[model samples]
Target: MGEMYTTHEEEKLIDIVLDSILSGVVIIDNKDHVIVDVNETAAKMIGLAKEDIIGNVCHKYICPAEIGQCPVFHPWQNIDRSECVLLNYKGESIPILKTVKKIKKDDHLYLIESFIDISKIKETKEELLVKEKAIDSSINAIALADLEGNLTYVNHSFLELWGYGDEKEVLGKPSVEFWQDESKAEEVKNALFFEGSWVGELLARKKDDTDFLVNLSANMASNEFGKPVCMMASFVDITDIKKANLLIKRKLEIEETVASISSMFISPKNIDQTINVALEKICELCGCSRSYIFRFSNDGTRMSNTHEYCPEGVSPQKGNLQDLPVEMFPWWMGKLHNGEAIHIKDVSSLTEEASAEKEILEMQGIRSLIVLPLYTNSELTGYLGLDNVLNTGEWEEEDINILSLASQITGAGLERRNAEDMLMNAKIAAEDANLAKTEFIANMNHELRTPLNSIIGFSDVLSSENFGTLNDTQKKYLSNVVVNGQHLLRIINDLLDLSKIEAGKMELFPEKFVILDAINGIKATMMPLAKKKDIDLKCNINIGNPLIVADALKFKQILYNLVSNAIKFTDQGGSVTIGVNTSNELISVFVEDTGLGIAQNDQGKLFNPFSQVDSSNSREYDGTGLGLALVKNYVEMHGGKVWVESEVGKGSKFTFTIPVENQITRA
Candidate 1:
């Protein structure tokens, strides 16, 4: 135990060797736990010089052991090594892994203690535990397996996800056995080996042998030599997600079918084609073998497959069924008559109520069928039928509801077809009537104008005294006859012209002429009548472009009709003016009369043939009620428009505009 036994130089040599090592070392007597020898590493570790610690008790510096409780001094206690702290000069704690063991050297037993800093190791160990806990609590299934596919480790979620009660059930077993598809497992293994990872969806098997869809990702784990030794995998169950996607796809198909059928009914050019397309879409969407629309007869005693569709190599009922008698299927007829649709899943399982109908259906190779009643105006009109000859199918409520909508669309289409037919027939009848009226007017104009002109000619001849000298009374009477005949001829001509316009046979011979000249001619002829009525007649022409290209004769007739009507409506001393506002763009003519204005309600009737403004005024004014109608037609034929503005007792202004584009008409 005496340190002076060794030379100073030898002790220094031993100290250098001890301090050169990374771990602190010290020696003590096993009997008393006394420090007999210490190395430079130990001196630096405990903050002491060799001389001070050479004889001190070991427990005072590094060991917090009780009397004779040192692990090395009392090896029989079985405490070989333990963690402890050492006090430095600054009274700070130094962490050390202190181990003591009895060693016999030079026939004397001593305890050698060894330790090093381990703070980083403790921190890293805690962090690793935290990560393990995180992996175990994850929602995703996580597992590790050996290269040979033996399950090495699994998390709690992995156990719960694969229908396993405990990890012991799957550990060390082939992971491929957990896959529903073995080929997919091979694929995953190959991907992990070649690409360092594998990611995809695959069908996986549970412990109960039930299959589920899973989104799986697996990565390779390697040893220190960089050789792949195991695999780490994470999975999420997606079985329900796959089912929902299928449902969404089916819903889209049904919606597309409904849209196509609705479009067909809205614009049905060919009824057969529309019905066929509708049937094809419905059949395709519902996975039916055939489809048809059976319309009920008027008496409800029979029905017929008016429209039918079938796949290739299938028999068509349209060619064979003609007015199928309702008595043939008694039970079916009763249901249809009550407005109830019929759906049969299996003809072989029909009850007593469907025996007769099922017998007929099976005779035609029908296994399953569905019928939806079609209605129009709250009355059952027909039915939409679907047949599945190959497979006995059960129709879902959602599918039945879609077919019902198809039935309604069929009803609307048929109803619209009937309406269109009626409209066409009515249109044809009206055209025939209009043609007859036009011909009648043409013949009457010829027949009435001949004798009327002869009467006028004779009256004028007699009044002229060409045949003989006449008395004053005879002269006055002849003048009256001529004036009345002229009036009647004018009325006949207006009727003929209006008929021509309405019949679309009226023609205009356009010519360039000063409209004022035509107005002058009319005014000269009408002034005598206006003077007789004590009314003033004037023509105001603002002829900026007097070289107007129009039907000059018709234009004069239009102005004459308006002016004459005004003069007739005006009282004595009232004024009648025919004027125009001309421009490069258009020529507008106004016939304004200071006289009794037409009523607001009666103005609508003013331009209708044979429609007078007022019954009371009709008795006072001489008119056939065709003047304004002819005026409107004539003005319109020249690409012009006419409108009237007036107030009660404030007179009226009838204005008409002729676009300059119409001036393109040449003589």
Candidate 2:
């Protein structure tokens, strides 16, 4: 029981030393080298319990006892430092650094063994070395220079950038010598020295004395004493980017010039004037010697230059190029007709196919040219040409596209003018034809009604016994004459109504009327016909005591036409209904019928004068097909609209809406 615990003071001292430092500590007896005391850190580091390690022989667990020597040993040998591995509870080797010192406590000899886990530090050091190698191999030119501007260090990338064969070539060279701009070079150097940093684009000279652009960033490095030691810089080559920026600027300018010219064509009062302006702008923006627009003759045998521009030194080819034979340049004309441009970078490159055109172009000192064909209504009408007389260069695809767009814009202007002229002529002709129709209808109404009225009146008198008493056979024939005469009169009236409405001459005479009274009157008049056909005619007046504003005669005519048409088309034993639905804003009327339903496609033309839904039913149904047309015209005259909803083999509902206030009333 006494051996199980150390003295209380010794235990307290052990805890004080163990908790004071981060490293694991263990004390071993001198003779047996067994762990007599262990701290929490030592037990955790070895992955074991403190109780298990305190009584264990140090060499048996971790001191590589079977191999060579123990780290915990007597002071006479003085073994202070060594590194080894300790096996954890799981049998995994954990790397550690070991140091030993002999201590005399309570006049007893013991070995103090202390160590630190160095596994993570070892791994971190290895990763740092790898990253340093990656930095050295980077593509960016990396260099370090002393404060005196002599190169101290440079990677392969830096050596390669300066066209140096080896590091010795640039070891002591002043970095400022590589910068071409003397003033800017001094400015950057001053900034690096005084401000501790500088970054910008500056001109740099190569070993061959050729200049380039570089994006360089430099920083001043310092020692712990706060004195400047050296400078480090990273350089990126940007020579190609500078050149590309200039090219893009030129292209944008050309596009802007072409766009401005296209906008002027929208109100082109004179084609030649607008084209001349375009030629001037195109020649100036494109850096060309001459620009021209040529129009083909109506006979298609020749072309004449209608507009042209020249930049001072170029000869004027506009007048001399007029009326040239089109066949002489067959290849050129062929390209134009196919909507393809003729881009000749050099006239000398033309072969025998273009010999004729080449001779003409060379006579005007034109070495390079681009021609775009212009068409009005898809017919080749003209061509736009740009010529380079002094300088010859390949026309870039972008330049050619801009010129082609210009030609298309010109063609649109021509087409628009032609269309406007045609429309004006059409309007005049339509007005004259309408006037003639108006005169004919007026004369026919007088000439037709005189004879038709006499026939109808005479038939009526004969049937009424006013002239003489007629036999049953004669009366029957006379009744047919009167019925057909009335039908003929109805057709004539409908024609007149349609003509008046189309001519915008229809007038509405509005009057307030009792809607219910009108509905009852229509029902009474239509009852005999419905009874003969055995149809169930019905009326649903949802509006209570409603007084509607509309022309009395026209309103009655609309109701009569709708009811009559519905009755005529409906088969026997079917239903015909008149529904008057009123709202605060308007009056909606529906004439629905469960009849031989109209087809969906045919319903569109129902209100077109003389249009029948089914041509085959023309003989079966006796009508001029003008009733619905007149109904639509009258409804519209009172500021209303009409439409139909129907499905084949089902039913139909014809609806019309009239604003409650039909027209301005006259006192």
Q: Model 2, poorest ten-residue lDDT window?
A: 66-75
Residue-wise C-alpha lDDT for candidate 1, range 1-667, written one tens digit per residue: 5332357888678677877878878877876768887877778877889888878777777757656656754567544446677766666777677777776756677777877766677788899999999998999999999887789999999999899998999999988999988987988887888999988999999888999999998999988999998899999998889899999988888887898889889978997789889998888888788899888899888888888889886788686677988788878877877888798998889998878777777777889989988886668877889999998868878768888898888888888888888998999999898878877877887788998999999899888897789999999999999989998999998888888777677888887788778878999999999999898898888777777888888888998899988998899899999888888878999999999998899888888999887667448676889999998888887878999998889999999988754643321
TM-score of 2: 0.66
lDDT of 2 by residue, 1-667 (tens): 0132368987788688786768888888876777888888888987888888778877655656433355444244445556666767777777777777877765677778788888897789889988668767989888888888878888888767778778898889888888788778778878988899999898888777777798999999999998898999999888888789988998788778877888888878876788788888888877788888898998889999988999887778887988888999899999998988989999978999889988988888888999999898999998998899887779878668777887888789878878978997998998898889898889879999779999999899889997777999999999999989998988888889888888877777777888888888888999899989999999988995488888878888899899989899898898899999888868998899988888878888899888887677447887877899999888877778899988887788899999877454321
RMSD of each: 5.2, 9.0
- Cα error, residue 165 of model 2, in Å, equals 3.0
Clashes of each: 0, 0
In terms of lDDT, model 2 sits at 0.83
On the 0 to 100 scale, the lDDT of residue 185 in model 1 is 94
